[model samples]
Target: MSEEFTYATSEGPNGWTIWQVIGRIDVSTADEAYASGEEIVKGNEKIAIDLSTLEYISSAGLRVILRLNKLAKKSGHKLTVCGAYGMVKSVLKDSGMDVLLAAKESLDELS
Candidate 1:
């Protein structure tokens, strides 16, 4: 069976957009997650990704996030990830993406 992933976007403080990702963000759903994030960043100067409900993520997902970070930099936008926990945070930390993406501790910390 194919796993389903859901990603939703909303307005954040100071008009920044927040993309709340739910479900597993693995190889099967990485593209959809990336596309959703891309659409939010297209017109906004700041974007936050909420990983509170995200259960799993793979290398493909990390690659997508890295690509988004680069795109955000070139477009003069800010990209931050919030609420990563357990294995999700471990993977990010292990891959050194936690540093590269500048993933923040929490939304409150960013505020």
Candidate 2:
């Protein structure tokens, strides 16, 4: 069987671009995740990612977000993550990404 990795992009307030990640983010989907993240970074300054629906993630997946954050920071852009819950939240916390990833409990906090 094959697993699918999917994401959606939408515009947010104050010229922010929101990307919603879905499904498992492991080695199987890390490459594609990076490609999509790269595409989102182009021509955008503020980006927010919603991980509310993401079921799982691995180290490879974390690398993708880390790279995206680095690129955004280098360009003077801000990247925020919101809506992380369950194991996804735990993963971010355990990995110390809860600090490094700029994750927010709610988008309202960012506004």
Candidate 3:
């Protein structure tokens, strides 16, 4: 399998933008992940990070998410996480990031 981590953005309902995270986010990619997500949150008022295609995320990845969340809050923007499944979902839940971030089970939940 490929080890590439990339992002795709699309307009979402409820005035939110969907930032789809594909591939893995670990120590090696965490910086890039944060940079990319920071840019997204800066440009949009509402963001929903869709992680359905995400395969893995390390603690570094979680840190990136948390930072983005804080950035959004400080900027008066809204940020939410959605579409997490399997190990990704488990990690978010186990780490309590799910509750802290108010992560949704699916993008539809945000809609």
TM-score of 1: 0.92
Whole-model Cα lDDT of every candidate shown, in order: 0.84, 0.86, 0.92
CA lDDT for candidate 1: 0.84
The sequence of per-residue lDDT tens digits that candidate 1 reaches over residues 9-106 is 77877766888888888889888888887887777888898888788889988987888888899999998999899988999999998888867777
Over 12-54, each residue of candidate 2 has an lDDT whose tens digit, in order, gives: 8778888889997899999999899888986688889888888
Give the C-alpha miss distance for residue 60 in model 1, angstroms: 0.6
Error at 97, model 1, angstroms: 0.6
- After TM-score superposition, the amount by which residue 101's alpha carbon in candidate 1 deviates from its true location, in angstroms, is 1.2
Q: Report the C-alpha lDDT of model 3 over 5-73, residue by residue, as the tens digit.
A: 899999999899999999999998898899999999999999999999999998999999999999999
* Model 3 clash number: 0
**Model 3 deviation from the true structure expressed as Cα RMSD, one decimal place:** 0.9
Q: How many clashing residue pairs are found in candidate 2?
A: 0
Which residue pairs in candidate 3 collide?
Answer: none
The TM-scores of all predictions, comma-separated, are 0.92, 0.92, 0.96
- Model 2 residue runs over 4 Å out of place are none
User: After TM-score superposition, what is the CA distance of residue 51 in candidate 1 from its true location, in Å?
Assistant: 0.9
